[model samples]
Target: MSLPDIKEALNEYEFKWKAEQVTIQATLLKEHSDGRVTGDITITTQAKEYHPHIHQSQFNFSAGRTRETLAKTLHSRVPDLISLKQWEDIIEQLCVKIVAMIREGEPALELAIDDTKNIPPEYLLEPILLKGLPTIIYGEKGANKSTLSILFSICMLLPWKDNPLGLVCPTRSIKSLILDWEQDKEIVQYQAKCLKDGMNLPYFDVYYRHCARPLANDLPQIARNISKVGAEVIIIDSLGAACGGELNKPGPALDFFAALRELRIASIILAQTSKDTESKKKTVFGSTYFTYYARSVFELVKADEIDKTSSDIALFNREANYSARHDPIGFHLTYNGTGIMVQRQDVNIGQFIKRHSTQQAIYEVLKRGAMKPKEIAKETGENENAVRVALSRMKAAGKIVMTDQGYGLLSKDIMQ
Candidate 1:
């Protein structure tokens, strides 16, 4: 009815639909008729021309129907004839047409979350963000640790159905520079093959650096190179290859870590935990600084008797100066037709309990002696409600006893 309304309708229609028979060269132009703006749409093909009179309200609807019908019939033939981007454009235009009809009936526009200032760089990052930090994948020998690292690299570069880690979404495009000192050329080729097949994404600038010592002299140079390429993430395959300088001292490692932060890039440094029985520490290698320096650590462990390997993903809180908890989130690895695939496995309750202080305190209280609900709450320094909840769970697990004297932990399961 109005000029603005008609213009809006046409624009919406353009967005919602595409020409069904593109064999018909289509031209849409506006004209004024009896104080009302109308559209004279011309459809010209190989042979004849068809002129269609489209009103403001009906323009979008008709366009959508035409597009839908044509798309269904020409689906198989369109890809062979047009480029992917062109096909995308055609589909997008059709969507616009369908959306135009509904726009008028819809309520006034609502404000959306302003993320223009929030978009990260378009480069891909490997070892995708989990728990707000980059993670290093480490495991025992023969565990396919590198394979897992490659899988992570692929996950970050590819578009997954949901966010793998419960971190922020609509992440900035990331650029990762992988320094694979281990240098298994075959595996690298396999990844490239996966990328070609679209099984994995090759959006990042991938580089293969083969050297005995990736950390000596090469570390800073590598950082500069990735900076030039605008990479936001870097993956150093193994700590052994990447650690040539004095690791015990903070000076060397500190500079390397600082360079990464300066470039606004996160690093995933994979390292192996030594097998010697003399070592008491649980982390990969080095002193507290290794774990201390890293923002997050994911330890991959192999089942002693079982054929499968498990990965425990841990979130390290820098401010707190320790992992909020140490129990690793578990995953099972298997080889699919293409390559190694990882599926999240079961939760480890023992690890889970040790990591949680409240749960530990409750268990401790029940272990010492039997006490009433109120007594147990006081002894555990927990609230009545919390104590009751813990008691219920412990009882369900058969870890605690409901005695006439009070609540007692089953001694057999006390240490467990």
Candidate 2:
């Protein structure tokens, strides 16, 4: 029997082989870690009314089990759907072509290093986001992590220069996408509109998708979507749903990180903080890989001050791979029925950092007029000994002035 030539589609993940009135399509091809090529092969007819002879089922490169299953299913379910000999020929061609496709690319190549100090790590937003790497922001639900991403997308989409947010956009303009797992398209749409209208900028598009499947399972479709829009960056609304389920397990974490690596695009991933009151430590809520694999990480915090129209938000740098972790970035947000606005501001240092560090708490108390160590302890809710120790260190560091009045800031801007 002559074998039909299988035609590879423009998308490397798809292939087709035609025989008689039926077309066999192999799609969503993936190479496993063990080097096995697996995909779905559907047998369909080119008729006015569409019906699948063998609805898509997963098949490996060898196609032995799949071929037998297809044959048995056809013979038992619907007799003589296709001749046995024709089926054998299609399976043989399919196996050969699948093997070739799986083995197409070189595993490794010669190193190409043209110069020393040639290229520095590129940044989409300096100190916050590295270009083409994942950045994580995890916090309590109402901390506005998702809102921050939306604003970042706007900054890049509008190509804001001397941006009010204090983060520089290195490129002229960036194309971005949003994959929302926790929210619907309508919510994101309204948020985008309110933000843009508040800034008084003309409307523009930022590609968006509402996602449900695990990123690893849905990479091909996501890749196609990214390619279609020429998106340079992606914002995954939250991490818990993106890993599918059982996010605490190592497998999902590994798979999620691998999927992001395969994506090869700049990303801002929002995550939830693990509820750990005992340690007073906040991790990315699920797997440690969510924090470890990410190129940069931040803990988002909203101030305790009650403001109906505004939020005092800060992104505290937790980790950075390319450089030192930075001082927290402070942004003030004001929103109402018709508009939303974000602007750079000094962190409301006292309330936001008080719980995390005794130094910060002491610093906050001393920012007002000078006070004795005993007074500082009472004001900051700390032990007198601890406050005394901190004050001694602060004086040695030239951060506080010692006077008849007691300890105080050398100047208001001393910390800066």
Candidate 3:
């Protein structure tokens, strides 16, 4: 069988048909007496209509529902058609173009669902300060973990209630969706007003998705539910509340994490940690699943202060600590007239610089191909001084390598 002509994918008259909504397009590669084998496409609202340009055979599709629905349908049809694999290549290209176009045009308002960027670098002093990353703040029943969670939620909702807390940074506009299993919607709202004194600077969209029936125990079922939310970040608040059945069994909790990854949303789950344990090293008390799978973990401990009102927040590293620990990166929780705000304790600029520099250097080297330090510096438009420093550090970190030919990235795992 010959390769299907790309031109056959669209109709010539589609250009004049005002076919702006090509959200669903199917190219019937071969028509059987009863059914047809198709190269399916579903794009963004803008790309919903199919238009066949004479020069461009593959029309760029859009993102979101269109792309997802199309990919699933085509993938499902793969087993039915012998030629499905061949059409898949073309379909793959179309899928990519659609996703890119949608991202550029829509700018993550509705389409950007994945939470890969929320994870902090391993070395950072404050790995838990990520904007979109899901984090769980768990402690002993009376450890005030729930109080802290409530305060965090209020800070996002009414950012302006306190001094620097209300300061609108680039990340302040971030959208957060929380499934408060422990707290009721009314209580969460009351706390928000109390925290912010009715400042009314709406910044977050809070959802009251109380899990009456524990779905976390059923991994597949829970995964399907979360995937439909289209949220970049999610919070369970208290892990045990939603996770039903025996957590120590290792099947349900592990499966829950797996489902979280599939949902492509960053989450924060609260878990309890016992104080009687002599090990200061241990933070969260749960199955190893707490340490595994999580890109970063933090253990908040009470501070030894003259006044009980003051709290000491000790940060921890679980997996990656690209950010250093020496720097004071924390917040001093204080109550104001309306709400609470965490005042900045300190920030580690040096650590941030090193972490970002390494990440950027690795990315640059991978993108520009194998090259020596001098070549890399020149290509990246960085001074030789900066390049040498970065290269030396990268090499020591085992993120890159030197060969007879030139230097190159050590790992191809860098995501595009």
Candidate 4:
């Protein structure tokens, strides 16, 4: 029979030919930095009443190297080990096919998003993570971004509908994998256990993989694990360590995302802000390309230190590609001794920008009653001047009207 069919899995090609106990396989078909097409090959043999043997090694996609690697790999003496000549011939055939395949490059599909069809954007996690795209949640140290992700992951893994997190999930459960570079499995394990217990879940079994290398360098193994665990959603535990290169450089940033895209699954990547972010405006602590490449980004801000049980947090949409920037959503995570509860709270916990826009926050509060600028400022924790400026802008934009009472929206149903 002819050589086995080559199948593309992400950025690699996998090929295998088998007949009963005699089998041969090839995988990881991709190029190296020096422009050589290389991959791993394996040969396995077992025969009736004879010993079974296996041999595996890296193979270069060239006739000369294939011939050398194949010659001594199998011989007539070992039952089912094809004759030397036959082995060489099979590898040679594989080399020729792979060389041609590599030169031709990954197949491309024609692009079309015709307006007539009008396909809407899809989400793996509504309003938080997009389906089959990359989204980020970045914050300073101790902000509990990772823990927040774990809470979301449980919602998706069990995929609880109408869950308390207020995040929507598909009817079907999606498996999740966490690739941790910042923390080891033990820490993650403890965190997972606590969350599971706190959430009162009977079971929480999302997969976890410890990572130290750049994602691209670990694609093969990660892909294998993804397949093994049936992971559809991946949570990258922070970006700095995963980058595995100069965090400030575009090359590392681009490569890291390219690797994620190659995995071809929905991803929620956790990231850290620069050390001085609290004193300055917070941005993801990496190349600007990180921001550019991401489909959506959220800046998570924690209000204060966690004393024992509760912490207030706010999520500000820094960028969104597919939809309108969301109103700031705030949450209060209460970790009681037995369980954890995440509830929607006013984002106005501490001194930071709160929901929709400051204007929307003001309008929401104003819907209760018209309040003066100082009252609005007091309600939102915004300095009086900033609230007045927002109010003035809202008036100029025809969004708000000044009245004897204080300030009011021109339209009551701003949501409309």
Pick by TM-score: which candidate is best?
2
TM-score quality measure for candidate 3: 0.45
Cα lDDT of model 4 by residue, 1-416, tens digit: 44665666655655555543455566666665677788777766555655654677877776485566566655544635456666666667677777787778668999876768776788878899888899999987888888888878888888788776677887888888999988887877778788777767768675799988878778888998999999888899879888888898888998888788778888899998766633536788878999999999998888864587888888888899999988778888888876667777766634454323567568777766778999999987767998999999988988788789999766655443
RMSD of 1: 20.7
Clash pairs (backbone) in predicted model 4: 124-131, 198-339, 198-340, 327-356, 328-355, 328-356
Q: Candidate 2 on 119-194: residue-level lDDT in tens?
A: 7789887767788999998888898888789988888877876778888786678888999889998888888888
Off by over 4 Å in 1: 1-134, 163-172, 191-207, 211-213, 227-229, 249-251, 258-262, 274-281, 305-323, 336-338, 348-416
lDDT of 1 by residue, 1-416 (tens): 10111223211132222233232212232222232222222222221243232112212223445545444434444444434444445544534533444333447888788756765333233223433244555556665566556555555554343533323333544555677778776667676554334333344434555556535445445655775766556677777657656666675566445433433556677777645534323455554566666666665655433433234433222222223534334555444445444555544433333233455566655655778988876765567998788778878887677888888877785554
List the candidates ranked by lDDT, beginning with the highest: 4, 2, 1, 3
- Give the CA lDDT, 0 to 100, for residue 114 in model 1: 72
Local distance difference test, per candidate?
0.50, 0.77, 0.48, 0.77
lDDT of 3 by residue, 212-285 (tens): 54533333334434556544455676776566667666766775564455445556667777445545344566
What are the per-model numbers of colliding residue pairs?
15, 0, 28, 6
Better of 1 and 3 by lDDT: 1
Cα-lDDT of candidate 2: 0.77
